[model samples]
Every structure is written in structure tokens, then in C-alpha cells.
Target: MTTKTIREIALAWKSDKQRYVKQSTYAAYVLILENHLLPSFGDYDSLSEKLVQEFVLQKLENGLSVKTVKDILIVLKMVMKFGVKNEWMNYCEWDIKYPTSETNKDLEVLTIAHHKKILDFIKENFTFRNLGIYISLTTGLRIGEICGLKWSDIDVCNETITVRRTIERIYMVEGDCKHTELVINTPKTKNSCREIPMNKELLAMVKPLKKVVNNEFYVLTNEEKPTEPRTYRNYYHRLMKRLEIPRLKYHGLRHSFATRCIESNCDYKTVSVLLGHANITTTLNLYVHPNMEQKKRCITKMLKSLRK
Candidate 1:
């Protein structure tokens, strides 16, 4: 086998991997490699399942969420495979285990009252940022996707908003240089590049603006330059505070949208597609919680159908 440390192989792997991935994705891999994997295992030439398992537990103890730890492992596995393919290292199969926590957080969403309050407030007050939040409340657009939107993507004629790209600030480590850049890249998955039909409220607001705004300019800024997610998130937080609304992460807007849809009895597959989820199961897992009232009604309906 070629004698290359994991660090060397990882550098080469990410460099080659960049051409095939979006800039944001490559940045994520690099950040995880440098911040976690390389520091821990860079000099090692071989990876054993036990060593990785230990690393997993250490990460968990250090406060990384199970999902985050799993994502890090995924990148680690890919790099190991690359090194193995090139004969630089040997791969041991991983059967890593994660501890199940009873405190798994339920999904957070705006209460129905808060949801109505924000929508009503935004309906009366108009700002580009508010418009973006309005879009999220009415349709389950992720923060990056909403920030990436341009006037051109607003199809008032068809009453749909087509998602094509997303904007974010990404950390990139090149050689010895470490820096961050604001990047605009296509949505994370093919399913994310989708068309969501605008509801009446959204259509009304967008229709007039589409006629006057520069098609190539971003919607949030109404300029060629874009507002990144962090900045927009701050704006959202301040708006929530001003309205005396309890804090919710910007992402909660998307969750609220999805929750409202499911509560309205929108089909699971349709909600999945609109949210750009890779699978309907993800949508179900996040939002298919049946309340006790619904449970009672379901039981009643089921029994009614079998009446003797």
C-alpha cells in the first residue's frame, strides 16, 4: 500500500471531490475534516472500527448531537474509501452505535396563535425581509432557499415560486489558508430544485413586485448582491422580539408551514414534495403527530365503519 497519512489522503480527496460537488457541500466536508477528523486521526494510516467507535462516543460526550456525529462519520467513511481505493490505506468496516436518548427533542413550531399573529403582522407591514418570512410561513422554504431567491424565480404568471439555488456563508480551508465566503449554489438535492405553488396571499404580494423588480436581482435585497442566511436570521429574531412573540429559530417558520399543512390534512406525499424532502417518510416523521382529539375521532370513525 502507498504510504500516505489520513491527512494527506483527505486533502487530496476533498480537492478531487470539489469538482463534483457544490461549493457549499465541499466547504462542509472540509470544515468537518479539518475541525474534527484530521485533528483526531490525520496521522493514522489505518482506520479500525473500534477507534472510530471511541471517537463517536467522545464526540457525543463533547456535546455533538447524534445526527451531527453521524454526518461527520459519513464524511470520514467517504475519505477512507477514497484512500482505500488508491491503496493508501486499509478500511475496516464500521458498526458504530449511538446511544438512544430519552430526551429527543420534539420538533419546534410556531403555535397556531403565533402563526396567525406573524402572518397578520406581515400582511399589514411590508419589507423585503418580512416578505421572505411571509414566503416561509406560507410555503415551507428553507432559509437558504428563501435567501437565494431572485425576482426571476417568482412566477406570478403561474403563481409558483421555483427553487433553483440557495445562499450561505461557507468556511473553506485551502492549504494553510482559512477563510469564509458567501456562496450561491444550487439547492442541496435534486428534489430541492422544485416548484411550489404560491397560495393566494403570497401570489397577491408577489404579483405586483414581479412587474417592477430587476429579474436578476435577489428578492431579499432587491439588489445584485444577496443577504446571507445569518443576517436574515438575525432580522427574523428581532422581528419576533418586537412583536412580543416567543423566540423560534428561523427554521421554525418552515416547520410551522409544514405543520399547518399536515394539520389541514394535506397528503403526506404532496407535503414532502413541496418541502423538497428526499422521502415522504421524512415529512411523516417530522409532522405526522396525531393529537388526542384526532386519535379519538380516528377511533370513532374506524368503529363506525364496522358497526354491526
Candidate 2:
């Protein structure tokens, strides 16, 4: 029986997996293997549940979030599974546990006033870059999706915007060298490939610009060369500073949009589809936190129903 080190198995697994996944997905797997998994377990000739659980605890103690740790574990498991299939390692099920008192922080979202303030300011001082901010607030496009958007995706006749692709920067590590490159790919999920109807205001704002821009030009830059998300995020940071608004993550725009939809009594499923969530439960868990006023109304309605 030949024993293989974790690093050997992982390298073999990556070679096999790369052909089956998207470039972005492959990049992420490589990053996790290099940065997290390989450094910790590369030379180990055998893997055990206890070792993996300790790794989980150590990652959490070092300030990595639960989600990130779990993602690492998932990659580890994939490599382990690949090893088992090739008779290079044994298989063992893991039942990892975290502190029972663990709590997730509330998601950040903009208040209605701040949300409106940003929108009004953007409309008043509109530029091609500023328009991306507006589109994110009105439609629930992620920053990557917004950056990848082209003028051709907008339809003036139908008053809709089609979400087809997304752009992201991925890091690559070669022999003693690390570099990064921008990639444009299909949306994160199949559901993200749908069309969103533009309200009259959004249509009116973008219609004239669409006529003058080349179809293949990106919306944010109005040029053939697209602006990447990092640059756009920096622009957002500066915009917030100028507006005297508190700093929120670029993703908060999507959250703010979903929150506004829920506040407006939009159906949960509709909101899920708009945000391109894979499941309705995800939408509910993230954006369905009822405020005190809503709770009070719910109680009152329950009492009223009982009395009737």
C-alpha cells in the first residue's frame, strides 16, 4: 500500500477538478488549498476527524468567520474524497461543532433616509460611474454583476435589464509568484440570469445614454474596457464620504434593495428571485427580520383574529 501526503493528493485533485469547474470556481479552490489547507495539513500522511475539528477551532479562534472556516473544510473534504476514491487515503465522517452560544451579527442595511439621499444625489449629479450605484439600489444587482453590465443588456422598448454576466478579479499563484487577473463569466447562479423590469424612472435615466453608447461598452465606464469591482468599490467609498453617509459594504446596496422590497410588502419568493438567491429560505433568513412596529402589528392582528 502506498501512502500519499495530503499535498500530493490535493495537487492531483486540483488537476482533475480544474477541468470541471468555472475559472472563478477553480481559482477559489486553488486559493483555499494554497492559503488555508496546504499550509496546515500538507505533509500529513493521514487525516482524521479530530485533526480537522481542531483546525476548525483554531481558524475560529484566529478570527476567521464560521462561513469561511466551513468553506475551507468543504475544500478539505473534497480533496479527502478524491484521495479515498483513488485508494490514496481512508475516509472518515466529520461531525464538527462550534460554541453553542455563537451568534451571527445582523446584516447591515441603509436606512430609508440614507437610501433616498444617495439616490437623489446620484440622480442630481449623474455620471456613468454614478449610474451603477443607482442601478444597484433600484435593482438588486451585486457589485460584480453591475460592473459587468453592458449597454446592450438594457432594453428601452421593453423597459428591462437582462442580467447575463458578472466580472471579478481572481488571484493566481505560480511558482514563487502571485498575480491577479480580471475575469468575466456567467452570473453566479442560473437564477441570476433572469430579466428585471425597469421602473419608469430607471428607464428614463438610462434610455438616452443607451442610444449614444456602443452596445458592447460597459455601463459603468461607457467604454469597451470595463471597470473592475475594486475600482468601483473605491469610487463608492469616495461617494459615501462626499455625501456624509456612513460607510457600508458594496453588498449592502443589494441588501438595502431587498430590505426595501420586503418593506413594500413584496412577496418573499419574488424578492428571492430578484436577488437571484438559490432558495426562498435564504431571502427570508437575511431580510425578514421584523421590526418592533411590525411585531406589534402582528400581535394586534392575531388578537383581532382571535376575537372574531
- TM-score of each predicted structure versus truth: 0.95, 0.96
Stretches of candidate 1 off by over 4 Å are none
Candidate 2 lDDT, tens digit per residue, 1-308?
A: 57799999999998999899988999899999998999999999778889999999999999998989999999999999999989898888989998766797988999999999998998899899999999999999999999999999999999999999999999887657889999999999898898998988788898888778899999999889999999999999999999998999999999999999999999999999998998999999999989999999999999999999
Candidate of highest TM-score: 2
Give the lowest summed-lDDT range of ten residues in model 1.
97-106
- CA displacement after TM-score superposition, residue 295 of candidate 2 (Å): 3.1
- lDDT of every model, 2 decimals: 0.92, 0.92
Q: List the pairs of residues colliding in candidate 1.
A: none
Model 2 spans > 4 angstroms off: 306-308
**Model 1 lDDT tens row, 18-80:** 899888788899899988999999999889998999999999999999989999999999999
What's model 1's overall lDDT?
Answer: 0.92
